[model samples]
Target chain A: MVLALSGAAQTLDSTGRATTLGLLGRIDPRARLIATLLFACVVVASHWIPTLLIALAASCTAMVFAQLPIASTLKRMAAMDSFIIFILILLPFTMPGEAMFTVFGFPASWEGLWRAVEIGLKANAVVLMLMALVGTMEAVTLGHALHHLKVPERLVHLLLFTVRYIEVLYEEHVRLKQAMKARGFKARNSLHTYRSYGYLLGMMLVRAMERSERILDAMKCRGFTGRIPLLGRYEYTKRDTVFAALMGALLMILIGTEIYHAV
Target chain B: MHIVDGALSNPVVVTGAVLAVGGVAYGLKKLPMEKIPAAGVLSAAFFVASLIHVPIGPSSVHLIMNGLAGLILGWAAFPALFVGLLLQAAFFGFGGVTVLGINTVNIALPAVLAYLVCIKGVRSSNLTTATVWGGVCGALSIALTTLFVAISLAMTGEEFIPAAKFVFFAHIPVLVIEGLLSAVAVYFLRLVKPEVLGAFEEVKR
Candidate 1:
């Protein structure tokens, strides 16, 4: 229970941190979003170490220019990269190739090591780009950007509504858990224990259902139609153009290297 | 169980994304106007549910509840699970943004299967039968999810076969746990608020 609540809190904190204004935050969200997608494609396509290194460098430069909280951002990046790191640690021993060295009596190979490094680089580059670009904007701003970008309306609304009520649902779950504990409920590997948890989740859904009725009624009373109007407006400026051009050039170069190697 | 970015080949990612888009469109079309808020709230429920980690023998596994989502939402499970995955990527980075399509397809498709496979038994008159079927739905969903994850990984390269196998073996306990929990949940709802099952009836029609 503690772990669950703490996870929710951590999610809130990290996202909340990203909403604060930064250099990337100043750019039109639409432009930043498009660039972020392009950067991800570039990172995924480019396998050359030099190009990947350049992508990493460019992402780092964006982070610095955004004036993001360096420590927290890196910490978040580390968390995201941890799984890949684990894979990297294991791949060298399992993958068949020319041996690099012996690690703890296990044969490590150059092929596996190189593959891990390439994947790690690509993963970090994409993650860092998102952190600098999409992460800088507020959730509402991001949603509006999607709305303007002609993303399906239902999806955009669903994303916003989910973001809006995630904390509320977390609090409700915490309360339900507390009530269970107050009644001396303990989960064991048995049918009775499973039944008790089922009651807990069922009760949550019941409550959420009732709450939704009230919310929908309230929205209707306020003259809300089916569509949510986006209040954010953006214009194309020199800054937007410059950012797009730089990103386009970088992606072309990355793709060029890949094609060069393939041929 | 989410797949991170840069983990999949381009062909796999593109195919998953295209399929996901189709699924979401179908889901939105089936969803009623009044039920839109319910979808959001349930998405939040799914997200929070995934945060609660249950300790097994050695390692802890988080609750997915995709089976529950599927049984309740039907085709709408596509959008509901999609929202949860999107928030997970955007907020905590548990999954990456680029792989959102594949992750959604992998997770939500199994859920829809669970709904199709177990709905009749879940709605049965016999209480024991209903509960048992609910358990099966829950268990089956996880089994299918792990299978999809494994397949996606294997498709990327032969090198990932071991990792794919590892994911399946690791989730053995999760399958049982979800089965039992979802059974209990279904039984409880049947007694307390049977109308909730009607959420998926329109989709069936």
Candidate 2:
């Protein structure tokens, strides 16, 4: 998991340099963000199997359009599924309906099984679409887009600062861990281990605080006026309009399927 | 403990979003402009810290450390943690986009509660008392967070009750590890640089 997280951080670092290279890279981020949100809401509201399958397919198509590495992205999605798998597994046994099978005197229900499947489809589709759409942008660009989308200035500034510093702090943590390893410290299930980890975090936090102080002084010296100016100019091009229309049409189809199934 | 979108009932998701917005608004209001750097860096540090997987009996659990965040940032922990969650969802797909609100509420609300409950004791002149309080804060925040998550799940439907209970019970070991780790970390902070623990106060001033 730690290695996986480090890989995620590395990806985030590379994303800054990899900007505007994919198929969706030309589309306006604001349009992508709004479209993703609409798609997620519509998909979540839809319960029909056909609707969900189409939604999942749409998300996969978006992933392909964004040029995200399919295997690795699906691996990440699988990791997320591991978190909720327990609850999903239990759902069948807990819900009252037609019994599918008996396990240790507990009967699993078809209705509950379907409910779990619905949740799985909805979650994967939304997260995949989100990654392919807004996640493909640089983190700084995302912050700027949010700022332009009427998110608070302070919040955007915070997001930008956090995006700027995650790598620096992550490196600091790695250095600390390496130093500990050099000192023959090994992590295990013991009090000594936990305490060492705690002290490591403590040291990291202290250093981070000092670094922030220095950063503040430097920014002040430059006469920063509390607001970090967002300089990204995003133009809504013909491509963006076309993309939005296509996504809108897809969402409309999803909603229509949901309503059609309902009626 | 991220509750993904579509699992939660509509009302639950809406209420969580509303509450999270309120918390983030208040948190940003309390955070002065000058303090943004400090808060942002600390938030990043926590984000990095959360990636550390500690060894349990067999499997390992990644750290949350919301208690430590609360002690350092106070109300600002809300937005700081929310930023972390947003980044995770975007970059890692660890959580869903629509359920971002409920996830933030589950993690950050307890962090603020820890801040309110343990800030004074954490600033105590007595080192032992402060360290113990720090442990309590860490344990308490995780406890509340798990409880909140369970409540969110259980509220969605009757069938989720068992899953909710399981979520809470499964995290018992995590609570202890967090408590111990937080206590020692607080002890180290008190010895090395006491002012870091009083960060929120300085920001307010």
lDDT of 1 by residue, A1-263 (tens): 23221111123354343334555556788998888888888788777888888888988998787665688778877877865565567667777899999978888888888888888888787777776776666666677889999988888887787777777888898998889899897666556666677777888887877787788889999987777776767798888888888888888888887778778
TM-score, each model?
A: 0.89, 0.96
Instruction: List, residue by residue over B18-109, the lDDT tens digit for candidate 2.
Output: 99999999999989998999999999999999899999998899999999999999999999999999989988898887789999999999
Please provide, for model 2 over A101-156, each residue's C-alpha lDDT reduced to its tens digit, 9 standing for 90 to 100. Answer: 99999999999999999999999999999889877777777888898899999999
User: What's model 2's lDDT at B69?
Assistant: 95
Which runs in model 2 stand beyond 4 Å of their true positions? A1-18, B202-205
What candidate 1 gets wrong by more than 4 Å, as runs, is A1-20, A101-107, A185-195, A256-263, B203-205
- Give every collision pair in model 2: none
